[model samples]
Target: MTAAILADALTQKVHQTEIDKELQALKEQAMVSGTEDSILVNKRQGAADLLGSLRLPHKRDEEWQFTDLSELKAIDFVAAGKVSLDVAAAENFYLPEAHQSRLVFINGFFTPELSNTNDLPSAITCQSWTNLAAHQREQLANYLGQKTDGNEVFSNLNTAGMTDSGVVWIPANIELKSPIHLLFLTVVDPTPIMVQPRLLVVVENNAQVTIAESYGAITTNCTDRPQQQPYFNNIVSEIYLGENAQVTHIRNQRDSGDSFHIATTAIAQGKQSRYQLIDVNLGAKLSRHNLQMAQRGEGTQTEFLALTTLAGRQVSDTHSTIALNHPHGVTNQLHKCIVDEYAQAVFSGKVLVPQAAQLTNAQQLNRNLVLSSKARINTKPELQITADNVKCSHGATISQLEADEVFYLRSRGLNDYDARHLLIDAFAGEILDQIPLASLQGRLRQCISCRTI
Candidate 1:
């Protein structure tokens, strides 16, 4: 063999050894907080076995070329222990719209004391995985950890270490009047910790529901540090929409600025189903979100609206894939990013229309605004169409605030900072207006105002 080839092989072997060691340590940690549910036990073991042979993704990988995991690898994190909090103390995190229909998880474990689900309708079933009934367990087995891109390593790691999950099931033909909230909170610790949180939502045929999911960090009395401690949050969510179902999903990620957050959301839509997603990313020193959606039946409709705001030295990456496997599918996506200071933002959106998916209409656009010379933005919007009759278009743009527009705003009797802030707000208002909840929209508007100032 050539000397270069020998060196490459040695590098691969070393990486594989490191991967194995990491997997073993995670598995041992999982066993300490293992679940008694038989189905979950089997699922965990299966994922652990699969992880044994897979290596961590690196810059050499195509999908992760722009994301660097070196900082994450440097921290040796242990599993977070079960912690308790008073319900009254967590009032600040509660939303008035979902006061009675919320589920709260702390450090990846369901916290019954801080959750309120007593006012939910009979058509909905919401509970933790450990509290699932026999029939529910049987149904969950069919979908849990099943719908994925099939190559997400962090997702598999979540399954391997998951001891509990938030499950939401809506029956057929039922329309929920209020939105359900899923709140996952991470607590900072003196020692770096790792937490895996999982969620499963299943909507039956002709059902309609709205979901608001969020992730944030909290501090306890004993540990009053200001979110400076490092932690890792690995999350996985699976959503299944039956035929003619309608689901509106809103996701918000506002973790600690010193933490690492990685998430995967896999969605499947049945015939004539409608799925709409409004995603907002605002925090975390380093974060990545992988969103995958597949149309399982004809006449499905999908919509995605995302906004990412980053500052300081933060890095945020979003990768989305929409597959139209059936005919008569329709999809529209718009992603926007605002980067300031030395922050960096990355976005890659892929739309696939195969030959079998005739008469598909798809549109994708990515827009970015840079506020500093050191700020960076990377965006790629792609459409792979094999269907001759499909109407598909994709485009991306990365630019700074328009000088002419800013000057025009300044002429309207506004200061330079106010002019720039107004322009930035207008850029973000397009996506924020589409959100279904007025309260959330107002909150997000305030957040944007503070960030710009």
Candidate 2:
């Protein structure tokens, strides 16, 4: 063999060894946590078997070219142990809008004391996997870890180590007036650890509901600290919308800057169903989110709005794919990113319209604002269309804050800082304003101000 070929083989061997070691450590952690359900045990074993063959994503891969995982690979992380928090302290993470309709998980373990699902309507069932009845567990075995194709390694890793999940079920023809919140909080640990949190939501035919999913850290001041230790949070969420059902999903991620977060959200829409998503990402040392939507029936409609804000040396990446498999499908997506300092942001959005998807209308756009010369943004908006009668378009834009607009704002009696912030707010507001909750919008606006200023 040539010298280069020999080196490549050696590198592959080393990578495989590392992956095996990590998987074994995670499996040990899962054993410590323990699983009571047979379904969970079978799923975990299957995932573990698959994870052994898959290696960590490398820069050589097309999907992970711009995002680096070396920092994550360097740490030896064990599974997180059960951490408890005072009810009063956990209340700090609750939202006023979902005060009575929230489900809380700490370090991937369901904490019933910190959760409130008592005020929900009778048609809605919100509980954790550990609390599910036998019939319910049997029914859920068909949906959990079944939405995605199971090609991504991080997602499979989550399934392999997952101990519990937050489940939401809405019966047919039911409409909820309030939103349900799923709060997953990670506490700073002295030793590096990993947590896998899972969620599943099923809305039956003609049912309507709104979901608020959030991931954050439990800090003394509710902010990143200098002594914060590094940890890993791997999460997966699956949502199924039945025929004619309507569901609105809001997801927010604000982990500690010293932590690593990887998440996947898989959504399936049935005939004439309407699904909308508003995703906001703000904090993490390194973060990646995979958002996938599949149309299971004809005449389905989907709307996606995403906003990402980064400062310091944080790295954030978002990959979204919308598959139109049936006829008369409609999809619209808008993603915006604001990067400052030495931070980097990456976005790759793909819209697939096959021959069966006639009369499909899809629009995708990605806009980015770079504050410093060193800050970087990598964006790719792609549309793969085979149907001739489809209307599809995808585009991306990357530019600094327009000097002309900033100057005009300054000329209107605004100082330099105020002028710059105004322009940034306007740019981000286009997506943030569409969020359903007023309190969340206000909080996000403040977070943007703090990061940009």
What value of lDDT does candidate 2 attain over all alpha carbons? 0.85
The models' CA-based lDDT, in order, is 0.84, 0.85
Q: Per-candidate RMSD vs. true structure?
A: 5.4, 5.1
How does each model score on TM-score?
A: 0.91, 0.92
Among all candidates shown, the one with the greatest TM-score = 2
Tens-digit lDDT track for model 2 on 102-201? 9999988898989998779865789998788878999889988887656787787778666679999999999998889899998877887788899999
Q: After superposition, how far is residue 6 of candidate 2 from its true place, in Å?
A: 29
Which pairs of residues collide in candidate 2? none
Residues 11-87 of candidate 1: C-alpha lDDT, one tens digit per residue = 33323444345445545555575635667766766675665555678999988898898888767677787888777
